[model samples]
Target: MATGAESGRRLRVGLLGTGGVASKYAALYGEYPRSLLVALHDPFDPGAGELAARFGGRVAASVEDLIASDIDAVVISTPNPLHLAQASAALKAGRHVLLQKPMTVTLAQAEELERVAEDSGKVLALYMNSLDNPVFRDLRRMITEGVLGKVGSINCKLANGMGHVWRNRPANFWRGSRAAVGGGSFAMLACHYLNLAQWLLDQPIIRTTAIGTNLMCDHIEGDDLMSAIVEFAGGELGVIEAAWCVKGEQMSLHGSAGSFAYIDNSVVTMKADSPFIGEAIRYETPGTRVVLDGLLAPAMSDWTNPYNQHRCFVDAMLDGTPVPMPAGKGVQDMRVLDAAYRSSAGAVHVAVHVAIHVADDGAVAEAVA
Candidate 1:
């Protein structure tokens, strides 16, 4: 362990925003031995004192101060557009960063962040803990073990009812702001699944089609129901559907040789010729207990488990384990999202182009660092 003057057993960390997602990271930090919450920063929170009291962290008056602190990393859970600026600050500060998904509101910002991450030689990660999830791990293993041959098609579906939290509610709801929060519920809520489809399949989206609307929530300018169809380079296709208005959750996966799904986290339905889909098989593969409890549990619950992601960050930073989500993939998701947005507005399919860049020093970077 490094000394207290140098970090000891705990990696000092900071938070840029204390929203729903940030709270998940904070909760996770509480459980990880490799990290400690040293500072908290949220410009709009009136309950900073209470938050600081619970977390035993200093309340930063600004993001700049948080960056300047003695933290080795930061969990940036700020809103959409703010991600670009906040993440850039953390990276430039020479701290590793774990950013909320969708990297940034635009491809350009995501690309820029990727560059900075390489330049700084810091681990810039996306909170895409799902990639390290039990279901995906199991899925990947099954696919690798030849349980699902060829993966001809995968339909990735997600749905959740956002509830009527925006009706004259607390002052903290920024779901309706596009500039601050970026796209509506889809970008914030469902973009992860879009990313999951690509990552879990080990492919990028080649083409995409999207349709969404602002029908239900008048509180913000974002859409309530988000849907998309993407084709992968492997000649495989996937469909992603998410609705902020959906009351129950469901995910179904279909491959050439099998099919599986879980509904409301209660029932599991699967059919595979490879015999790995039976009652004897557990979704939590033997080696992934921490990931199962930390990332999968919280994601399965509406509340995502406390510190799996942060701990994952620590494992990567200290032990050099391969992290599930890299900063570059975050940028790729944003590119697909950008194509989806353009597809919706034009009522036509758009080609998805995720620009993968290599820095002058030969370090590879994604558009969103």
Candidate 2:
């Protein structure tokens, strides 16, 4: 571990997958003087070579070879199913991990990895960079400052036409296959909002009823659309919608004294029965400020961007700070997702039964359902 005094030292970083998302992460390494891309690994040799050439890293022959290398951290951008095994191996090898989202496909897998990370005493951060959105940061502040007084409900929707784009394309067909990607649109997309909901509201979803279906795009076995109604422990209602068939994104939060809505890139707030009553204040984040590819791309601005997320992880390793998004949060999100799926399949509302306990050493443990 690099000491806090050795701030000039760079953390040797290895890439576990050379895919599109991995390339994006690699591109941002130059922005942080403390992060160095030292090695790359992928089963696809050609792809690994290509990324290594573009990103200034040597192509390792295998995951084992990469783990055994002198790297302080490994960014696992591999597929959903491989996350558990690769991240576990890296942690056990005494390497900190920066894992891509969804953490793992199932709650069991997430729990097992969490235990491994705890035992290894290495930083295990799930990449949910959407939390870095400035708009979200501002809204969280508003809530904390009581600007949105007594918040009651939140409705969020995220949709894109990607379902149509990948409908019959063989290259993108794997994304639609449940066997390869795990769950459907919810796993691919909704998980982002789910994580955000918990972060912004600072509440855990206690109950959920959901429905998912592949209403379009017959080429894939997974659902193309999903909707869920969830109740938070704090008595807040949340309605979440995610799809690859729609065209835009929107989110709104209702409170007893005020309301906040974020549609596309615009944020509007109205305070009820106050001086701002009937007057909606609006703030528009520039188009460039929006992360076009969501968490998959680098942020154009400096405020709470993906680059900041990476920088924070690097700093935590060197400074002994807490990870921004720990594996425990990922497990909690996955458990909620598990409840959503079970509710959808059983046609009944399912209660989320997971509990997160933080040990004295800052290790996180989850109680089984």
Off by over 4 Å in 1: 1-8, 169-173, 277-307, 348-369
Give all TM-scores, in the order shown. Answer: 0.80, 0.82
- Put down candidate 1 lDDT per residue, 228-318, tens digits, no spaces: 8888877887777766666666566676666666555445566666655432245433212111112223442222333356666666776
Q: Which ten residues in a row have the lowest lDDT in candidate 2?
A: 286-295
Q: By TM-score, how accurate is candidate 2?
A: 0.82
Model 1, residue 245: C-alpha shift (Å): 2.5
User: lDDT of each structure?
Assistant: 0.70, 0.78
**What's the distance in Å from true for residue 235, model 1?**
1.0
Backbone clash count for every predicted candidate, in the order shown: 13, 0
Candidate 1 — worst ten consecutive residues by lDDT sum? 286-295
Tell me the deviation in Å of residue 324 in model 1.
1.8
Candidate No. with top TM-score: 2
Those runs of model 2 whose alpha carbons end farther than 4 Å from true positions after fitting are 5-7, 44-51, 265-307, 348-369
